[model samples]
Target: MTIPSVKTILYATSLSNHTRGVFQHAIDLANVYQAKLIMLHVLKPLSDSNIMAIQSYLSEKDIQKIQNVANQETKNTMKQRLADFYQDEMAGKNLPEIEQIVVKGLSRYAIVEQANKLNADIIVMGSHNKFGRSSATTRKVIKHSGRAVFVVPTDG
Candidate 1:
């Protein structure tokens, strides 16, 4: 019998403050196994209500400008957070391949799709406490991806 080893890890983040623990888990596993780490953040598309509200108050050009600005800000925020995570948790250490990915879509589908694209061996993510142990995104990923997932408790 042959044991399977990890080669790629997908670290899915909601970009919430609670994700530090989850990211740490991913980093540790990747370093231990010398696996590539793929950091992913999925942003949900604007809801119809939100779009209608914006359209009610702003012109089409104005809405486009606002979206552009928002997109840039989100990218900047992700970069800064990635740098902070690396510095705070893994400063001056040799690690495996690391990539940052940010996309606008449903979190569950996005995470599963990205993980499949990277052929990830495992996924690490943050979860709520026992009370809300399973989030919709987490559940969906588990159900559809058919991949191993390690969910760290963010409430702790």
Candidate 2:
């Protein structure tokens, strides 16, 4: 089948230093295709067991306090860093509409679901190239995405 003209691209990131290269690649692809860029950050949800375990080690009040602090810190960090990156990318270029999405769920599944929902032409993400577990997770995402995925090597 002929490759369709990409009109929208999803750039999935974890706001990690290593993922910077992947964001750059996404910007380049968006520029080339003149496509809208969507930046996605998935925050893995805290399981009930995990919450209960934390509560067991600390008072309920203390646990709530810690959880709130952690969540706020994460949100602030992601927001500031992503804002700076996006601003820099669009400084003097005719950038397409860029949307930032932050959601709580499984990264692989959430990312794939968002891509499908947004009708993204392509999904670009950074890979740590970890074997075994990580590879398996990536494979699952690729299999279920039903869209083009470009995995950029973080080490390279």
Give the per-residue lDDT of model 2 (tens digit) for 1-156.
986799999998777776778888888899889899998877787899998888789998997797677767776876787678768765776656777777778888998999989999999977663321244445677889998999887762
Clashes of 2: 0
Query: Candidate 1, residues 51-71: lDDT per residue as tens digits?
Result: 999999999999989777877
How well does candidate 2 match the true structure, expressed as C-alpha RMSD?
3.7
Q: Return the TM-score for candidate 2, rounded to 2 decimals.
A: 0.74
Candidate 1 ranges with C-alpha deviation above 4 Å: 56-62, 129-133
Pick by TM-score: which candidate is best? Answer: 1
Model-by-model lDDT, in order? 0.82, 0.79
Give model 1's TM-score versus the native structure. 0.81
Q: In model 1, how large is the Cα lDDT of residue 53?
A: 95
Best by lDDT: 1
